[model samples]
Target: MSVGDDIPDFPATGVETIAAAARWAGEHFATVPAVVDGDLRWTFREYIDRAESIAAGLVAIGVQNGDRVGIWAPNSADFAATVLGIQLAGAALVPLNTRFTVTETGDICARASVRAVFTVDGFLGRPYADEFAAHRQERPEILADGASIITFDGTGEDSIELLIARGTDEHRREVDARVASLRPEDTGIVLFTSGTTGRPKGIRLGHGQLLRAYWQWGGILGLEASDRVLLSNPFFHAFGLLVGLLAALVRGTTVYPLAVFNSADALRIIEAERITFYPAPPTVFQTMLQDPALESTDTSSLRIAVTGATSIPPSLIRAMHDVLGIERVFSPYGLTEATGVATLTRFGDSVETIAQTAGRPVPGVEVVILRPDESQADAGEIGEICVRGYNTLVSYLDDDTPLTDERGWMHTGDLGTFDEAGNLRVTGRLKDMFIVGGFNVYPAEVEAVLSSQPGVSAVAVVGIPDERLGEVGAAFIIPKTGASVDEAELVASAGERLANYKRPRRYFFVDAFPVNASGKVLKHELVASVTAAPAAG
Candidate 1:
């Protein structure tokens, strides 16, 4: 049977809105541990109650049903609660990346017209509230009038605790009424793109779309109430919010939120919390595998591992099973525009398949590769990957330009090819592809070949200006711990495996490549760095 054939239907019905889904989970998994953070633990019922109280507080603070509320905090139980509370109050959520500058944050807040922002005072020694205050002072006209900044932990009047304390019986009734009035088509989230190529744009997604997509995602991962999930990805990103937290709520799984990712801390949490489901980017797993203490660490509880967002080596997949003892590993392909997911690998896929290809499209979603002329590409032919399904974004926030064409296909700017078995192998971004002399060289293809080279832990390939060929490939590599890379050996290996045009003309050994929150390498930054110092390579 195909991957889709054995998948079960969505577990519940009539739960169109996120508010309703939270209520349903609370009733079904009332006594189950919903969140575990430091010394705090809350059951599903208690978690939902807290979310409802937050909703009441939002209502009491003059937030309207159709307004937008921003959450600028890290991944914590409080962030999770605030997300549901925004939904319960019938307001769309706008999650701000914790790494964003004040200018970037202010731009998004103004564009999304956020009514209130929930932040923290000190996270990683940075005061988010103070930074936002500075932003408001610098660009006062950009923000909506009376936009409030409420800290998650503080004693002042603007603290989230104070806001929650203001929840009265009347406000609770108002929250309930708003929740009941919510529609599946109502906007649920406005997530900004990572802005790797250019300025970030807000992608708006509805409640029903997120609910349906992640329900199947959870089912495919075999998520169950007995599972303990370690959410290491940032909550601002779709992988953490929709796939990690929201899916856990639907599946009744216990969640342990990690605000920051330190391999040692991650291993300790897995051993301490008995974390069964762990999902993160390939970098996280690679770092953990390279940690000297990995051999002695107790990670026996880790069962399912999900990773993607960059080229993955099959050897890494095998090491996850042989070394980490993980029973299953999956790699998925998605972007901010497609609700953070489009294709996923099945449970029984081979390590080679899981590492090389992003697997088949999810149930109810149609994926096809179209050439530049708008014709469908044959199997094994590279083209643009387009998606059409219930999970497509509702719209670009405040932008009238339509993302989908007349046929309802959302043309993703990603390049990929499908095998005979319908698995997609994402080659690279459309904008990232460069022409060498006359041949088109895809960075991902070269990066994949170089990743198999010895001593190479991670690699990112970008095209640089070449006076002779117009553009040539340049690779920035991060060597394995205590391992040194020989440039002559890499060149010889590349000549054997890749064509002359595809081989990187220059290589730069670096400590690390700059990555966004989703663990995607910022290629533009790599190119800019190379441009500034032409002699470095």
Candidate 2:
């Protein structure tokens, strides 16, 4: 039997576009609490209305169909509202990571040619709006001509309040017209990759692709109106925006947006709000389990837990069930190009399966293991994971490069194998990339930055095992001949150029690298050297 062939029936099957999904949610789940952020609360009816107003606001600000709009704020009700609003206004949503430096954010804005960006001030002691303004002033060509930044809490002309106030009856009509004209094939989102190929590529996903994949994902998780979900993941990621938010929206699940994750606070909210659905990385659960408040916190409300990592200890899964009282736990696999999800473990899966594998492919999606020569791998043979289905991305923005082959399979660059029962065990990655605290880091991207540093002749980065974080980048640097390199200066330079997560945790000054016959640096040897030498750095 084909994968995705046995998908169960789900609600809102006729909702094609995100605009229609919002309207459907309002009509069916009206009066149901949709979102809760601090003191702000809104029912589905009110939430949809507010989103429509934002749509009108965007139209009033000269946004047109197919235009790209950006949101550079933490997880909040306004961020969620703007997401649906952009879709309603017939614009593609480009979510910016809050942890990104000004240069990184500016590059995305320039690449996407975003017309306007919605942001907030005073998040994590950083003035996001002011920093973007400085970036624009320093590098005027880094953003599209006339691109504007609108802050959520400001009262200036560029404030979101004024933008919303500009919405009139005329703009509302335009927004409605745009919504009615939307098609499933139209682009709904443009999510950038983690620079796996040295430069981040914008992934274009269609309305139908997101709705189909995530609707099924939510259905598989048994999401419903009674479930209150705590969204701790940042909205900039695919898992947070599409899997956590969009899936919960369609299922009538009440969402609680947590901008930052604190173990004590998470436990407090879970108990107070009776949050039933919680999804996070393995590190989060580990941290919560270690928190002293765990003993006093009432966590019986947690029913479902979802997580994924390179390596998940089976003991952790048992602890989550035995300690936290979570009834269902799922481990899934996916990437940005695959619409955020391709497979998921079922409800009754064993603890070992949930921990050791990423489960089988989702309904309507096909996953296969391919050998180096593009042949199908045996059930137990590890090879590149390929995906083909409606969930595949429409294209990469501004690049004519074809991601899918003639057979319509997109190579995932992840090494994995399928069990006889269709369970997929992710073995390793074909690309020189690693996940640091659930965020992907590409060595080439890090090397690109380190190579530009003044005293660095060559640099190679590799993922080293970290107890707290799954993995972290370790940089091996070769200084220019007769030039002294200061580790402190390099650290400061990297801190300025890269996000905190992407920065190397350890720096090793090396004269030469272990190379192969073709002069390729052996990254595995570098990783092995760290294991052999305790204080190599």
- Which candidate achieves the best TM-score against the true structure? 1
Candidate 2 Cα misplacement greater than 4 A, ranges: 1-10, 432-537
In order of appearance, the predictions have TM-scores of 0.97, 0.82
What are the per-residue Cα lDDT tens digits for candidate 2 across 1-537? Answer: 433345565466667888889889988999999999999999999899989989999998888899999999889998998999999999999998887788889898988989889998769999999999888899887666766688887889888788889999999999989988999989999998866335778999899778888778888888889899999988988878987889988899999999999988899999999999998987688779778899999999999999986446677789899999999999999988989888889888889888778998888789999998999999988778999988875689976666899999999888888888899988666767788999877675577567666666667889999999999989999876567889998899899999999999999999989864213367888988997895778
- Give, for candidate 2, the lowest lDDT window spanning 10 residues: 1-10
Q: How well does candidate 1 score on lDDT at residue 319? A: 90
205-258: candidate 1 lDDT, tens digit per residue = 888888888878888888899999999899999889988999999999999999
Candidate 1 weakest ten by summed lDDT: 1-10
Cα RMSD (angstroms) for every candidate in the order listed: 1.5, 10.9
